[model samples]
Target: MPDHDEAVAAALDSYQYRLLPDHIHSHRADPTLAERLIDSFLQQLARYADRRDLDIHDTLAELHQQRIDRGGPDHAPEYSFRLGAQVQPRQQPAGDKAGNPLWRGFITALAATPDGQAQCTVRIPGVNQALHLTTAELEPADSLLPLPTRTAGIVIHAQEAEQTIIDIAARLKRAAGNGLATNEHALADLAQLTMRLSAWSGGQPDAIMRHLYDRIINAAHPPPQD
Candidate 1:
């Protein structure tokens, strides 16, 4: 589980990787489309205010004018796509944004990895150029990946959430005896649990369960006889 802040952070991260536009310049060039995109972004941003902590005050018009003057990090005015209710707008430990060069790319593929991470391939603007970046590296501003509303349906029903905790405990018992680690289902369920826990506990259980899960996974899978 993540705290309100951490969940908020992760949501922002997801939006960057799964929402933002790939070819921002094209939208920037089209006045009508660009305006619409900004409006959508603002509306979505406002909708999530009850669930998030954003510090935005300006409207679509102000943001547009700011973009025209300041542009993005590269100094070109470009607009990103509409973020979903579960998506966020900012990232933490934002060191990469400070100096790294961001490339415009579209996520070509997504796959769940054995190590509990998502593997994604991205197609850059130029022909025949693709980059392998995971969900951790992808962001709405840096890549164009579409996330469906199907995910928004993952509401935290009280009974279901309680059952999830019970299920996770049972799996831990199995892991201990089986010397288990890297179960795909366990990882995915844990991730979803974190998201739901954020809603239930406002992030109180996030760190506790996360640390416990890591310890169990490590204990279950010790090094083989070498």
Candidate 2:
């Protein structure tokens, strides 16, 4: 039931978490592989936009804006992996190409080599020496932790709240159409809701939702006069 944008976002997230490392690892020797992959991905995105009747240029612009809003290319994973992030070797190091078991480790440091090539220093447990590796040579360690009960509950509640809000708006529309409510009042209410939703600046959602909840409760229960 997701809209085109939501679906596309989900697909991109999946590709990043699931397939990107493999693609990089497989073409580690080819320095131009990242550019080629990006070009191919953009072509695929254009095709998807065409099929969805979306303007490809606008979609690209929106994506670029989002990246800028998210701290720009400096924060991109390709530029620097977060320190302390768990990672495993994706490619064997030079002179250690006996196809031995790759050790999982935590990124202890990040820096560029003399030639300006970015690299990570990973600390493997029980191993005295740390491994210096490029981004293409490492992948995030597979998650082994179980989902927290509280986190799961919050997700379920949020989904239910989203559906309830949609249903309430739909019923309001139906009531307005049937003359059970004034068109002017209904339009004003809907417009206010839209404005509030649009005013959200990608901060904590609970804050805005709580404000709306207070407004609804106050409207339903007026204060007593002296």
Candidate 3:
């Protein structure tokens, strides 16, 4: 009989062989595309589990519900950005090509026009009112500096650290189960951290770092009771 790890690997390989096309298999050469494919697969699996009443944790279900509550549009066969996701205009607005400063903002809402065009309501930092724009007009605001620069290198490192934390937590939960009180607290904390990280507006890195440090310190040494 195959061991648990070998069985899992064999199942995954079978699924990939059956489900993935040659074009999709080529995505393994690109880390970003591969990560996105894995996330999509997991989300689909979560939905399948929910349909079969097998979602015990309900963590992914809750995340899906939150996405819907945040005005994420449901247009089948078309991808839509969820609310509160940081994005930048793909092109500069008319008469605003001076310094070409990086304009970043969060998706406040989503809508569809009568013409069937998807739109996003974005709240830029310095802007007073939210601006409504087409989905194609915006892209994810993940890069603060040009590639190969020191700041970009740090961003890559941070991304790797975030992914490592998530991967470790996922493995620990799967190995030991989420029934323990300590595991529950850890999951809750990790969820909150995910929210905070997603909502970051790419400003005041020092302040963000300090806030995270304070959180770790407080968690380690909580306040004394009276």
Best-performing candidate as measured by lDDT:
3
lDDT of 2 by residue, 1-226 (tens): 4365466555555655455655534333444654555576788879988899888796475445434423423446433456665566554335447574555556778998898776888754334226798765666553212211211122112223333334345555456557785556444444443333322222133443443554444444448879
| Better TM-score candidate (1, 2) | 2
Tens digits of lDDT, candidate 1, 1-226: 4255466445544544456646444443467755656566657877787367755554444445434423323344242222121111224354555443433334456666788666566543222224565454444442111211222334333333434554555566676677867466555665665555444323434553543454445454645888
Give the poorly placed runs of model 3, Cα more than 4 Å off.
1-77, 91-101, 143-226
Which residue pairs in candidate 3 have backbone atoms (N, alpha carbon, C) closer than 3 angstroms, thus clashing? none
Candidate with top TM-score is 3
Pairs in clash, predicted candidate 1: 1-206, 3-203, 16-139, 16-140, 17-139, 17-140
Residue-wise lDDT of candidate 3 within 78-127, one digit each (tens)? 34566666566664436336554455666778999789888888765333
Report how far residue 29 has shifted in candidate 2, in Å. Answer: 38
lDDT for predicted candidate 2 compared with the true structure: 0.49
Could you tell me every candidate's TM-score relative to the true structure? 0.23, 0.28, 0.30
List residue ranges in candidate 1 displaced over 4 A: 1-156, 207-226
lDDT of 1 at 172: 62
